[model samples]
Target chain A: MTDLLRTPLYGLHLELGGKMVPFTGYDMPVQFAGIMAEHQHTREKAGLFDVSHMGQVILRAESYQAVAGAFERLVPMNVLGLGEGRQRYGLFTNEQGGVLDDLMFANRGDHLFVVVNAACKEADIARMRAALEPDISVTYIEDRALLALQGPAAVDVLAAINPAAGEMKFMDVATLDLNGAQCWVSRSGYTGEDGYEISVPADQAVDLARALLAHDDVMPIGLGARDSLRLEAGLCLYGHDMDEDTLPAEAGLVWAIQKARRAGGEREGGFPGAQAVLEQIASGAARKRVGLRPEGRAPMREGVELFATSEGGEAIGKITSGGFGPTVGGPVAMGYVPVDLAKADTTVFGELRGKRMPLSVTSLPFVAANFKR
Target chain B: MKYTEEHEWLLPEGDLIVVGITAHAAEQLGDVVFVELPEVGTEVTKDEDVVVIESVKAASDILAPLDGEIVEVNEALTENPGLVNEDATGGGWFFKMKVSDAAPMDDYMDEAAYNKFIG
Candidate 1:
């Protein structure tokens, strides 16, 4: 606890009975009101998550286009095409077509504001600075904290405080004054539900969190449920599902890569690992990320080796993110398997505890995404 | 009734003994979504992982406290595992085992020792 960093809501989490644990470098709450209860509450009603540990950067250059161009060099996404106030998920790739980090960058009309994973943000910022010119301002905003309001009832609760927030659709962004604090509110979240991520001032975090928690529909959620909810949504976690060795396409994140950067497109290949990524796009990856369903009640956790049922039980892949999905009412998992075996309904076996359990390859998002289109 | 440092409880019943997790263990494990008990007739050694209790976030092993052959398992756990969280000491008892030897009971913790150990 002495060495771990504390979030603005650390004291508040302790007051709310959050079980504190060291995650990355922060003394974060792993659960509050239990994992299952908080997960169910977030799915059925609304839950607020304090995601302040993630890095927030304000990148500025000679011009807005110049800023986008500098960032596009590091990532495979079409940053230049991103519209004003519009947010798009981007991937920072390595020369071998591995993901350096997955992040959200919004075209804020003047400069590009980005949010990156907490564990890799420092290195992520350093990498960006190393590539871009010194004149470009790569400012890591440390005085701000992020909060996620998610679920079916999230829109109504947030809208009550700021009507403009409710009026926005999925993936929409607006910088509004909420309770006298200027915030960047985005109608997007990791949970497979209608939600918003608000970037608020650090000093005002507790007040804003308390105000939101005051709503009957909203409760405070912790990291345990956050993982479960995101897993149910088929979203890949940074360190677990992907790392520097995992290609974006192989991780089922090819959708984040735009066509303009692919082969026979306007921008052929310029980003790091663009050649490998483009080549993989033309010729599909050897293995692909997929969802897995256990035939029994036992959860097939991460590191469990997967095997094809045929050919004397040949090893195929391994579970990356696996756990019991509260919404799905059973154990659900995601792993990388051979391309041939990545199809839905393909039979595979998860070897755990010296026993083989039958697992079926299924399409991701075990629960339907309720994002407002 | 006696307790183990690993959080298992043993209740004497003639030659056979019932084993289950303590209330402290259940509370720490949180919501029990699934419980996998060793099959009846299976022989287990002390401190071996005989039962696997799964919460939403993680799976924990309930270690055996003594050498024994399993005689009966709590069938109700398969249908409703949450019973462990509701009543860890009573209906949530995992299995009944025929002790291979009772000498190991000397090393097991009593209620006072177990409570203090957990605290």
Candidate 2:
């Protein structure tokens, strides 16, 4: 096994008696107090996550607009309309319009800040470098650490440290002085809740994390709860729900692609697989992503085969991510199936442990999102 | 009472041996949420996976310490499963089994030795 990477807050995690496990090549805490408690705490109160392992990349150029235009050509998003101090969730696709990774892009005052998943950071950087215009430069901010403070009480707790933070709306960004340290705070998160993603200097990460935990409503949450929380919120985990073989259209992320990028548009940004993506968008994709609600208490996990009732019970899809949604109080799953079977309220079957469990194809996001917007 | 190296404890109860996870194992597992016990009369061999336990984070297998036929299971665990987390070595007793052979008893460590082994 490869040696696990340590984050800036590794010592703090150890000090808190965190149970460390290998996650995305990093020694991350799977739980602290307990998984169910931590998961519930985040939903009811607030939870601090040491997400320093996520990669931070700075897109620099002479002007912000120039870099934004160049970035729009690479990813399928409305970057041109993004104002200063705003962040947008988007995806980087391959030649076949398949998503390489999903990431958050923020238009900082001078540079564009991009956060990619830790496991796919290296590949995402390479793709950005290859796709970015010659004049636009890209720099990986490895010296920085990312922290996420999420839950219902996130706003109140975060405001205690950074007073101005409460003013930022969802997807908005602001460079603030956090306890005398320069930090970029974004009103966004992976969990379907109102939260903030803070990028701080590597040295001061532990200090900020400590201050956040000092609040009564804030507690240290681990990767275990984080996965369940995101899963309950119906968020797509990169490697689990999306990969190079999965197209954004099929992944139910067509909204991320701006109308201008569609076929027969007056303005066109020549990104990879534009022809295929536009065709899929115009005619509707063959297969589409859908949420599944399995009938029983047993959690349906990844790799389980999905059978289509419409196709005479023929297996047509497979689960990409599945688990017990703590907040939803049942089992929820996401998978790709034929377009006809991907409609909401459609009945399907998931073969779990040799038994065919009845499932319903529902709309994306099993639970209501609590984003600040 | 004796303990296996894998941190399972076996208590002598008449002709049957009561089995449960050790305190050390429960502490390591954090919080127990669900327990999957084998059916009564199921035959099991030493070191065989006879029961499965799930915590909020991950699932774990409970290995049988001796060859036996399952006689009784802790049905209470199905509801108040947290018993395993609160008192793993005591009230968390998973099942009772009639020993098929007494030879494997020699492999189990005594309380003092098992404590030292865990430490």
A1-373: candidate 1 lDDT, tens digit per residue? 4699998999999999999999999999999998989999999999999999999999998788999887888988888998887899888899999998899999888899999999999999999889875867899999999999999999899889989988888877889888788999888999899999999999998999999999999999999999999999999999889989998878988899888777886886899988898888878899999999999999999999998873356678899999889999999999999999999999999997878899999998899999998
TM-score chain B for all models.
0.96, 0.95
Query: Per-residue alpha-carbon lDDT of model 2 for B22-87, expressed as tens digits?
Result: 888998876676687899999998889888776665568889888889999999987767799888
Pairs clashing in candidate 1? none
lDDT score for residue A275 of model 1: 85
* Candidate 2 structure quality by residue, lDDT tens digits, A90-136: 88877887788899999897889999999999998998898784788
Scored against the true structure, residue B116 in model 1 reaches a CA lDDT of 89
Chain A: TM-score in each model: 0.98, 0.96
lDDT per model, in order?
Answer: 0.91, 0.86
Candidate 1 chain A worst ten-residue window by lDDT: A308-317
Best by TM-score: 1
| Model 1 ranges off by over 4 Å | A310-314
True contacts kept of each: 0.80, 0.30
Instruction: Let me know the DockQ for model 1.
Output: 0.81
